[model samples]
Target chain A: MPDERSADEHLLAERLIQALNLEHLAVGELSPTAALFGHESGGLGLDSIDALEIALMVQKHYGVTLRSEDPDTIAALTSLRSLSAYVLAQRKQ
Target chain B: MPDRAHVINLCAGRLAFMLGFVAAGLRGQTTLLPHSLAARQLEAIRAAYPDCHVLDDSCKSDLQWQDSPRNASLDVDEQATAAILFTSGSTGVPQPHPCTWGSLAALGRLDAQRLTGSRQMNLVVTVPSQHMYGLQTSVLLQLFGDCSVHDGKPFFPADVAAALRAVPAPRALITTPHHLRSCLDAGVALPPLDMVLSATAPLAAELAEKAELLWQTTLLEIYGSTEAGTIGTRRTTSGEPWQLLPGARLDCTADGAVYHASHLPAPLALTDVLDPVSSGSFRLVGRAADQVKIAGKRASLAELNRLLLQVPGVIDGVVFVPENGSRTAALVVAPHLAAAQIVGELAQSMDPAFLPRPVVLLERLPRNELGKLTHTALQEAIR
Candidate 1:
């Protein structure tokens, strides 16, 4: 199930990068667990500003709203896998 | 509270930030404004001020407020240390710049008169409160002037619009050139606004004009630095030169220029060399240190950056001179345009010798809270 979730997140992240017009990065370059935000950029090299657009894209595609002030936002937006799991759980609710 | 608190951490929402700012002053604590609330950054501030308390949303709840104005009068000493702001270090290390309550107040008075005008506005700030521009324009303006502020540091165009809608008219939007560009790209419907204020970096006049047309409001760009604070402003649509703020004067020296303002206790020398257009107006020549003698043709990294951003398909970009070599290189965020395409277009307008070699196409620049790229970040990116 975890492996399946990982694959799902990887695909979602790839879709996200593409949707955001992040042409500098490719799907293959980033790992499923790569850090999406912060100074220690795992691979994709995103930031606080990038988070806003990504959140909007997430909502548009997945019908999930990610708020910055939410305590779970940091954990959820940590990586593609985390984001995917968070979105999956959020949508179910 | 002791006789004075050397350092006080300020991390909270907009209203808390405002309340904490006033509370700290009353308590004689110099608010330590960190550029970001990152662990390492906060650790550094904590290391500097060991007694620092984390004043986040959780702690803000502990603070008590009165519904009615207090009968007891609290005297505010104008000369007291208000905050010690750290620069984004585009030039070098994030150096501390201490500002007095008087200094901020003086700038606020001018901002209220010039930027806000006669209208009583409700400011919807897109920039973070920790940022100097955000601290002064969005938060301090509301405090000093007859205006109110919305608490959220709204991002995305929709959030920005919603934030604007939350506030009553005549409303003002305080943001950066980068944020404004993003808003324009989103093309989200914004509520009617009285004015728009921009700072942090040089705003292209074309974008400024487009913003005015889209929002149907005046767009004003503020020109200042961490060292000098807000010193000049201009209406970008008219393509007018930046006029010095009231009680501000620039005296050009052989090196750069000396910055003198009534708010500042003493005259401070600025790193940027200015070309005085008139008595109180000047054009930015470039930073004295940003000049590079490439191929015996002098050019400014700032000007090259301006040209890089102007390129079609280029979303965001920066041109920086490598410390190891005389040649220049650019790390551009233009995913649509290839490195060769950017170079080819740049060659048409700029000298061939000054064109960035091996222009690095980046997903995004490592801009700080103020939307500025530090020299260290640029070096790391190139590496």
Candidate 2:
């Protein structure tokens, strides 16, 4: 089951990278487990503004709404894999 | 207000923020509003203002008077220091500017006149209430204007649409050019709006026109900074020349032009070069400082350029703001490094949003006899 979700998360990460206009970052470089928001380095280096941007992108691309005030928002936006899982779950609902 | 209430912290929803603001002021505390909720920034602020207390949605504060222990009256001491908003300092640290309740309330009255002359307005702000612009338009306006503010801070277009829908008519939206662009780009169906207020960055005329057409509402742009509250405004359809708010005068002095508005405590020194028209309108010629704001986060071109030079580069470099844009561009003299390499190195230290895009490698930077790159020289260098 983890293997099946991993492939979809990778594709979702690529799409998000494009949506974010993070051209300086290579798609392969952004790993599934890389920290999204709080980490200073070793990831895509996203900020609060970028979080809104990614949330907007998710809403547009996957029809999944991510609210900043949601208690689970930080966990959902933790990484590419977490965001993908959250989107997948929301879409299923 | 406690004896150590000289410093305070504000981070909450619109209503809570309002209550906290009033409560803190009653106790004679100057609220510290951190633009970024990052732990590091908050920690640094806490260090400076050790007595600071955090306020958020989960705050168990009782808005009702019965449960409240403080007997302080609701009357706002107009002259009391209301808030200290932190801006991205020129030296890469956060700079705090204290704004008085009187100043904010005065600007609110001016904004109410410009936005809704006689009729009341219900505001749904997309920007966080903690921001200076948000604090003024959404929170402070309610102090003087006959306005009811929605409590939610929605960022997404759908959420924004829903927020507007939940609120009453004659509703206005306070948002940034970045959020407005995202809403437009998302193509979400927005509810009918009375008007839209934009600031933080320059709004493109094309996008403004599209938004107005889509919502059939007037779109107004505000030109202001943290130091100075809302000063000037213009409809996007109109070309240039921002009309100074009513009773707000701009006068040229030996030091520079000073801004004296009815709501300000005293005359404020203007840093931007302005050409005042006889009709009380003004055209912005240039800014004295190389400060640029993107997505409401302000950064200095000098600081960014300094960081660019520090990037293990082989040689000289310069960062210049693109014309009529918030994104910055860099011209580096490093021959061995690729654009990606330069950007990657910058990402390590600088914010990804502020990183210079289109990092152009130049043989040399054009400098005059004074070794300062003039505007014409930069234009030629980037070319």
Candidate 3:
């Protein structure tokens, strides 16, 4: 399969794997559009603790804070593609 | 419909769970609270109780509702088994402990008197209702203590803050140390709360002090287990011993302690090592060997290691919580399988929170000649 992730998404994916300590998952193996949370979905199967780690990493790396109460923030965290776009957009601001 | 002896209540929402509880109670059936909703655990529960019915949020009843008199009285059998709460035992299997209606009601009333002085309070709980702590504070308290609980189980710091804001005054946040730390780290704005209840694991004095200072509220930590309901409470920041609830007493044994409560059907021998300071208060020393608590969930490290070794292509492995670490870590000597593959296999039987983070693959563990791993050797290997 062709790699669908953009340059920004690829960078964010590497950071996520390192920050979350996902040693088993390679950046190339990660599907950018797949679900980021939930066990049933064919995704990373991360939990709330990982979510906190991701939030803290995003804040430190891109100066972007993801609030759970914000629907936009939750939506942005749905997948790597969306999270990359959200972080890049926030960084540009 | 054929009658069943028990009903597995898997409702995620508080209201739906309460409704399921009441329906099962009215039918004279015991509610089975599984330790987790994981497929493997649920399968074990089903295998044990072949005649039990499973109920969840997606379950719909075809029966039409019939209006009853407003003042109709409901009779309850206090001696009947109300719920069988499953806790992860040291042996790795989920052990079921039955709670009678009388005991559950008594627990609720005792907790209410001790925590809220029987006052009407709104509760915003972050823990799931399946857990004993969540069931006692959120469901039982509401049923017998005249309190109300928010239906949604709000997770995340911002969501928890929003939930607290949505509720009125005299609100209590029933959560764990992990969740409390997240909320504090996020530094989200929260409304004034009457009290904050922490349980499932020990709360640090510094974190409790920070919460008390920031929220200007009393931060009370509960000491109890699934076997014994709410046993004691203490103001975490005060560095004080836990004050046992009324009608609860501890009898120290050679190994550990035995907990007796008015709500319990029988005395339960506790796995926690305790030091008695007074007649009604005790200081927690530590837990017995093999038990590890992470993110409010308790599991046996020995059992986890056994499960790790049981994974396919896993020749040898050991799971341990690194010194001063929050999550468990593992060192495996599986040359054929990757770290993620081993974790994925273990995830089938274990809770997600207990899964080892940063699983390190090595050629072999630093085991001694007797094939026994020491703490120092394991720590050195992980490092």
Candidate 4:
């Protein structure tokens, strides 16, 4: 199968796995398009605590701050692909 | 709305929750507040209270407001049940404790005396109104005490900051240790606040000191539970013992400690171990056996182990909190199922916060000739 994840998505996935201490999961197993929050989303099933950790990780790595009140931030957090795009877009500015 | 004995309040907005609660009270209907809004948990609650109405944000559209006479005196029955809050008991079933209107009013008054002290403060609360802590600080305080609440439950650090900024001066932040830690770690610039209140989990002195220094506000940690509302308060940075609220007393017994208050209908036995420092002050030692708190939510280790063993192809398993560890760890002897697979199945019934991390799979659990799993043996297996 072709590698569907972009380079930035792969790097973000690595950081997420490490930051969340998800030793059970590997970088390649994380789907770039999968939902990252809800339990029924058939994704990593991360919760609010995991979201905070991701925000901290993003701030440290890309200098992008994810605010909870922002509608764009909420939309970006829906999936790994969206989060990667949001981070790249923020860094460009 | 059809006549019902109770209303299951699942409203996400604070205003909706308060309105539904007061409307139910006016109709002599009790409001049920479940610990979580998870589908399975709500289903269990609905099964128990089959006749209760489920009130949610969608019901807001159905609300028709009518202006009442100005300064009309609203009479409330003191003995009527106001709300029933659920706590996840050790048996894996949620136990409900009913709070009367009188008791809730007393608790709100006491909380105000200790927390706000006659100040008409605006609160930005991060916890849900369904929980006891949230209900006391956000809803009851606003209704009975001198305070108003922001309508939203802000989750993220930046969101909390924004909410606080939106509120007027003399603002307070009502949150848990988990959210407080996240807010501090995110390093979001927060507006100046009069006070910050924390509960649900024990706040570390260091964290409290840091919060006080950064926010330049007094940080108070409340000690209470679902059964007893706002039993005591402590300035976390002072490292002092908890001062019991007026008219509240703690008595140590052979079985366990029991809390007593004039407002409570009966003396309630406490699940937490307390160290009595004085007649009016005590220090919390820890929770009783089988109860573990993870990220401000309580679950039973025994219940977790039962769920783990109930998984298909699971032979034997034990869920335990490792010494000095906050999260639960599990050792399972299931050859057919992988660790992640077991966790995935467990997640169906358990909250994600209570899910065991680092589930270790072993061929067999170390047991003695007496068929007992000792601490030393379990530690060796995990190691």
Candidate 5:
């Protein structure tokens, strides 16, 4: 049986990569609960500008406005996995 | 606290509330917020320093605010900025400018008259009153320029329209190049004006030309800094001489960057790169050391780095313009990102001329022991 969660995660990773122009970040490298939101940017080795660009892209693509009001933006943006999940949910709405 | 003096910032409408405390002569931390909320910062003091003798517009009720005289005399001191004025530092660290009573008054009366002829000129500024440019044009210039001012932060095209409606015709719009571009981009119908003043960054002749066609008015570009206040004003498209404001004179250094101030004081060294216009006026080429002229456009390496770091996938980026016939090359560090993807995103907001022509990507950017980029590291990156 196909796992519903895996399908959702793959879809999200693909969407983020395209939207942010991160043509190189393959999907399998990202863990669903990975630390995508906080400051490991220098330590864990991710581009900071890429993160902001992704956030802007998410805001523009999703009808949902990302602002201080939304608590989930920070958590969801922490990693490709989490962002995918949050975006999947936003797509439904 | 004896350490800080209480101030009312009377020009701002919301700031008047603090007047009750400042008028009472209370000495406490008069933390002035950034110019965006100059009025509210003073108003908060009304409640914060009720016991002290304070004064400002916040003290009056809205209905009665009109009747209240805007004038309030302040004792001038060298450390006056420690009490009254505040500004944006751009860098994370923001510092206050020392505005003595004499300096503020000089800025209001003499400075305004010297820059744009006629005392009591109608004033219009989108720059926040908290900023030096905004404060000078809107408030200080009101008292000194002998002019009436229109209050409100005109940010969007709609906001500019509303602000114009509030002020009568024959007004001057004091604004920055950044915001002005956005207004022009919006393609909104604009009011005719006597003049427009551009500051904060160099006003491109192309932008000045666009503004002239749009509004049918002269757009005067100002060249100076927060520390020096506004010293020189020029009409870029008009190719007019940069008229030095009163109490300002120029002294060229070995490098040719102008040093300016009043005759009473020694001329202060300026970072502005200039071409002397007659004896008094000059043209601002760009900041001497921090920028490189690419295709006749001055590009600040610092501002570029700041923008590059903000890109979604860019962990870090550093640019170096080699002196070898102005080779515009930039090196970016993308530990987890691809070089091609990141550079494509950055080129959007940045001017095409300033954008790195041949952007180089690296795994890690080299930095000195002090965490600063050295010339050697820059050369290595370029190679």
Candidate 6:
């Protein structure tokens, strides 16, 4: 069978790119360990609204429930790798 | 007892005036306005209703203005009518829209069901308290939604983060597109947001998505005018026809123009150009009155000028028509930017007739506290 979790992560990455109109941003530019939000130079600046929008989209499409009260939501969305890893974990759950 | 039916509306009055309205048999319904009216405006209204008590927003200074939390004692009919506030006129005047407690209350019911699913809401309003959007979403809806209203205005994103951090959980944000955009620019960590509601100026879809992703909340945009109260709301990216509130209508005439009606007082004829999707919904295309007649060519000066403002390095800009029938002149406010260079860039977006020739440069345009511009004020800058 296909690597379902990896496929889901790619699908989500595509959705985020489309949502943000980041067509100029290539898939390779988005590494597993690339920063999603941080003070680092060249980091993709995802503001709070973008964070919320991504969380909502994840919930709406993948059946992942992101509670405002979640302990890991802020941490899980910190980087491309973390988010993909979190989504994979969520799929298992 | 003057039947209470003849009185059109009642709003947030001082504790004393609140008593007078009840004592005189007026239904004391609260509409969302700033905590009070300025002393002069209140005095004029007092003259109009000598028997009715007048609540004045008479603070000694800005320091006092920031400290007051207006509470009222009147137990008027919760369903009584209230005043309508219009967008402040571009002519340096303000417009008032009339609404009723019954109509606003109905909206609260719809919002509460959609938002809270029957639980009470705790609201943290980020917009100024006076405007129609604030009144409907922050104040009146607070009462009808069974929400506890906070007494503060959070401007900077840091301030907003701090307030949300301190407030009780399950807090919702009531704010404007301007304020919301500023927050996103600041890169602050937001406290939990159950629901985020924004109105006043239009909120772009990208920004709305950003907001939802950051807070893990649904960001809903409200569509209505000061005249229409709140007709309907829609999701930012849904692109669906607006679902009208329980009782609302958009009447179209032969000329393809739209008029508005609701459980509101007297029919409101709008200056907008809209394509009605159904009896209840329409897609608004620029306002008809916003069209400028330049040498017999009809053009949207607002959009044209807005494009000028977006030019790289341009901070704030506006093009006001010369009331004396001269061509439209542009006035710009920027930091050490050249007026001549901006005109060169604006040439790409505007026709020669619509182009602002001999652009007037100022460090800042003279706008009122609300950031609204006027033709007269722009003219004064050029002169």
* Top candidate (lDDT): 4
**In candidate 6 chain B, what residue range of length 10 has the lowest lDDT sum?**
B59-68
lDDT of 5 by residue, B275-325 (tens): 777677776665666755442234567877777788887777776676442
Cα displacement (angstroms), candidate 2, residue B207, comes to 1.4
Looking at model 3, the pairs that clash are none
Candidate 6 residues B1-45, lDDT tens each? Answer: 233323322332222222322333334533323222333334444
- What overall lDDT goes with each candidate model? 0.72, 0.75, 0.83, 0.83, 0.57, 0.58
Model 2 lDDT tens row, A6-25? 77787887787666655545
Off by over 4 Å in 6: A1-93, B1-81, B84-87, B114-118, B254-262, B278-280, B287-383
Query: Which of 1 and 4 is ahead in DockQ?
Result: 4
- Give the residue spans of candidate 4 off by over 4 A: A1-3, B59-74, B89-93, B312-316, B322-326, B333-336, B362-383
Per-residue lDDT value at B82 in model 1: 89
Query: What TM-score quantifies how close candidate 1 is to the native fold?
Result: 0.73
The local lDDT score (0 to 100) that residue B356 gets in candidate 3 is: 90
Residue B324 lDDT, candidate 5, scale 0-100:
43
Per-residue alpha-carbon lDDT of model 3 for B195-233, expressed as tens digits? 999998778888999999999999999988887878789
Q: Residue pairs in steric clash, candidate 1?
A: none
Best by DockQ: 4
A1-93: candidate 3 lDDT, tens digit per residue = 434878888899999998887766878878888889866656677777788778778877898877665688888988998899888888899
B51-98: candidate 4 lDDT, tens digit per residue: 899999877777643532112233579999999998764333677889
**lDDT, residue B251, model 3:** 95
Least accurate 10 contiguous residues by lDDT in model 1 chain A: A38-47
Sum up the clashes in candidate 1: 0
Query: Residue B75: error of model 1 in Å?
Result: 1.5
Instruction: Report the Cα interface RMSD of each model, rounded to 1 decimal.
Output: 8.9, 3.1, 2.4, 1.9, 8.8, 14.9
